[model samples]
Target chain A: MKKINYNRELCDFCGTCVSVCPQDAIELSENNLEITDKCTVCMNCVYICPLRALEVKNEG
Target chain B: MKDRYDVIVVGGGPSGSMAAMFAARAGVSVLMLEKDREIGLPVRCAEGVGDKGLRSVVDINPNWIAQKITTVKLISPAGMEVVIGTDEVGYILNRKMFDPGLAELAAQAGSEIITKAYVNGLLLDNNKVTGVRVRTLGREFQVKASIVIGADGVESRVGRWAGIKTWEKLNDMETCAQVTAQNINVQQDAIHLYFSNTRAPKGYLWVFPKGNGLANVGIGISGEASRHKSPFAYLFEFLQTNFPQAAIITTVAGGVPCAREPEKIVANGLMLVGDAARQVNPVSGGGIVTGMIAGKIAGQVAGQAIIDGKTDEKRLAEYARLWQKAEGKKHKVFYKLKEFVYNMSDKDLDDTAKIALQIPQDKRTILQLFKTALVQKPALILEAIKVLT
Candidate 1:
């Protein structure tokens, strides 16, 4: 399984992750951005984050 | 908060702000919403705008300009360089200040401006967009409007929510990454563009000088190439090789729609502008000017629609007609040029660079380069002349 980790402090909520996500897994609320379970570890959000707030880890 | 407005513009970038300003200037009640708490934080663009385009839309404000550009250098894959002098000059903007400044202009023009107001979806009445449902500061609200303008950018949900078919193919999306770095050596008055398949892969890299050893260095890669490697990785490598000692000040990454405007941009009671409408220049990947132009048109038409009490697709079609006449025709040609240039092999690019170098440095112009690049398509010569001259 692949899991995603988010650093809330680093996130500026620019919503680039939500924009690039192929799985429609990210959403931005007023203060925080949520990555849903549908995130397929595609790593698009991880690479696109200007603040480097997202990380994807492979858990075997 | 007022639940109704004559015009509701979603997004506070140049397009949204301009739309709000023009709409409000016409005595219409306008409200502009920005998703971010700050207008232009986490800036995603290289921030370069041509002088003519900027002057056409807004007054030249010294506070908004970071550097004045007088020249552009095109470097080929094989390291050949062709430098072209700009006729009207350009500017690398301080977007952090520029975006807010435009928002302030909108506010001053009698438009209500709100930050941290993230538009979540569209409010539709009988398959026509009538308003937007926005979430702000942990509270959600629905604001009704006679007209809705979606200037929300490339990942525009407002357009999608309205069923406008805003989907873009992978090839049309350019994944981009940029950093403002200090202590980098750059020509103070020139923007350097590097074209190479190995470096950018179906797109190009840019070093836009922001004066005094500061520059916005960035790379844009086609979505097809981005699927194989991250744009950030390429940018990192480029920086390590070029400006190893430079300190990174700010980093940004996003996608630019390098495609023609969507076939349909206006729906009943709603319209799309800027990146939401995919109005970016296909070759340069710049949208600020075009967005503002579209914003002005949309705003004017929107205000007129409100005045006439008719906000249907037919009335708003004036915006589409006007924008297509203004720059849409040129953009269509640029799209074809982008497809042609991006598809060129490294050898072809190298050959083109060699040809460009043959022109006298003093005589070298952007139009001449375009002429060389489009030599195979002799049919486009007249169109190139129309664009350049």
Candidate 2:
């Protein structure tokens, strides 16, 4: 499965990723960005992140 | 920690703040939770509002005014320009100050305001919202409320958590990119709008001047059309062509819901306002005024429901009824108009502009321009009359 990784240092918690995610997978809480199991790895957030804080990874 | 309140308003944008303010003014204990440490930072909006649309709701604070605009210029694909001048004015806002200022007003009206409070989910009892579960500063806690008002923006989780279908079609979503640029030569008092399939693709590009050689340059492309090219790329190309010497100050990318309001804005013990409710104007993709209007109505109804001791869907349905009567009906018409406009070819748009320009400049109005565009649809003439008048 392809997974997502978020760089906390680069994220400003803009919530743009949360809005673009069709599956409701990404969340921005106080601690950090959390990707849930519902993620289809469609990479919507990866492209939408203004700061380039999100990256996609394949973890088989 | 205290965990209960009469009303809990989620998100601290214009809608949430207005909801909180009105609810608190109604003599109810209201709590407003904002996820960001500061309200309105990382501004996402182009921040233009018509004078009538804004002043009808709240007093215009001078501090929030970035620029006062009196003219609007529409540029067609073939470089045809049609300028409309009117006594009716518009203002571009400094959202960084405008948002927090509205929140401050809510606080002054007696709503308890808390920043850095991110709502993780709802606390439900028997499928009815009882409160919200929040995470703040690495701590998790639950706060109970009689009514949960979801004024959260387009990315609203509160509505979905409450089981309302808040989905939008790809064609109805506008992928947007904006930048505040310095040293751009723009008409100081005129806002420019550019329309073309190649330039914007089912959307439009805008240049709103903020005075002193600064302007907000932005583009909004329909999400379906954006598949071939990102909104950022479209905007970058436009900027390079028009304002090559402009220095970019900040860049922002986001999505705007350009669809009809969801059928259901209220559920058991819950109500949605603002972008969560999809109250934005489909044609303009502008929501500040509409959201605040929805917020006002939602707050009033929620406050009344609290006092009446009935927080179910039946009582909460008044919010939807009132909003539909107020703006939802018009928004529905605008949605249809948006579809009609988006379907137009570049040549069609150029022809429409040429036809509109045939009319004398002094006699020209936005209504006349729309009439030219929709001249083929006689039925829409009546609908446009109702909407424009």
Candidate 3:
């Protein structure tokens, strides 16, 4: 499975990813941005992050 | 602090503040929660509102006005430019100041606001919302309220938490990027909008001047079209061609819910306002005014419902009914118009630009273009007349 990873340094936390996420997995706030269990590694957030703060991590 | 109130508003944007302010004025105890530490920072909008749209809701404060606009410059991909002059006033607002100003009004109306007080989820009782679960730096607790107004904007979770279908499909979502830049050359008193496919597929690029060579330059591409190409790419291309010498100051990206306002914005004891309900103008992707309008109606209805001890979906439907009667129906006309306009090919747009030039200068208004576009649909033209005029 491929899981999504986020880098806090690069994130703007603008909630762009939350709107485009088809699975409704991303939760954003003033200080924290969490990708919950509902995320299916859809990569919508990864592709759409304007700051490139998110990526996909492979699992074995 | 007390854990109970008559109403709780989530998010502190134009809609939330309007909801909170009006509800509090109705003599109900209202609590407004803001996820941001500040009332207005990290602006996610182009911040332009029509003169009439602003005045119809509230009186204008000079401090919030960044610039007064007198003309609109519409440009085509082929370099065709049509300048339409307007007598009615328009403004490019300083939203960093404007949003908080509205929140101040809410506070003056006796709405208790807590910044950085994030409402993480809804507190439902037997399928009816009774309150909200909030987390602040000080502590976390559940606060009870008769109604919750979700004015949480495009990334709204409150509506979803309340079990209303709130997701905007990719086709209806306008993925966007914007920058406040300096040392750019453009008309100071006019807003510039560029239409193209390669530059902004199924969307448009805008330059709103804020005087002294500073402007908010932005672009929006349909989420479906932006699946492969990001809005950043399109925005960079536009800046490269138009303002290569410009120095970028701030960059922000987001989505505009360019979909139809949900048929159901009210669930049991819950009402969604603003972008949460997708009350944005489908054609322009602007909601600052429409959101406030819906917010006022939502707050009024919610206050009355709570005072009458009936806050269920049946009673809350009055908000939706009044909003739909006021602007939601017109939004439908604009949505249909959006489908027709956004689906046009690059060539179709350029041709339309050429055809637009054929009309006399003073007569070439946005309404004229809309009438021409919907010529095949006379019924739609009739509705547009009711909306535009």
Q: Going through the candidates in order, what is the number of backbone clashes in each?
A: 0, 0, 0
- Local distance difference test values of all predictions, in order: 0.85, 0.85, 0.86
Off by over 4 Å in 3: B371-389
**How well is each residue in B226-334 modelled by candidate 1, as lDDT tens digits?**
7657788899998998789989998876788897677789999999999889899999999999999999989999998899999989989999999999999989888
lDDT of 1 at B327: 90
Cα misplacement distance, residue B335 of candidate 2 (Å): 0.7
lDDT of 3 by residue, B208-317 (tens): 99888889999988877777788888899889988999899989888888997776999999999999899998878999999999999998898888889999999999
Candidate 3 clash pair list: none
* Candidate 2 chain B lowest-lDDT run of ten: B376-385
Worst 10 residues of 3 chain B by lDDT: B375-384
Please rank every candidate by TM-score, starting with the best: 3, 2, 1
**Proportion of true inter-chain contacts also present in candidate 2:** 0.18
State the weakest 10-residue window (summed lDDT) of model 1 chain B.
B380-389
Identify the leading candidate in terms of DockQ.
Answer: 3
DockQ scores for all the models shown?
A: 0.24, 0.33, 0.56
lDDT of 2 by residue, B180-265 (tens): 99997878888899999889988899998888988899998876776657788888899898889989999887778897777799
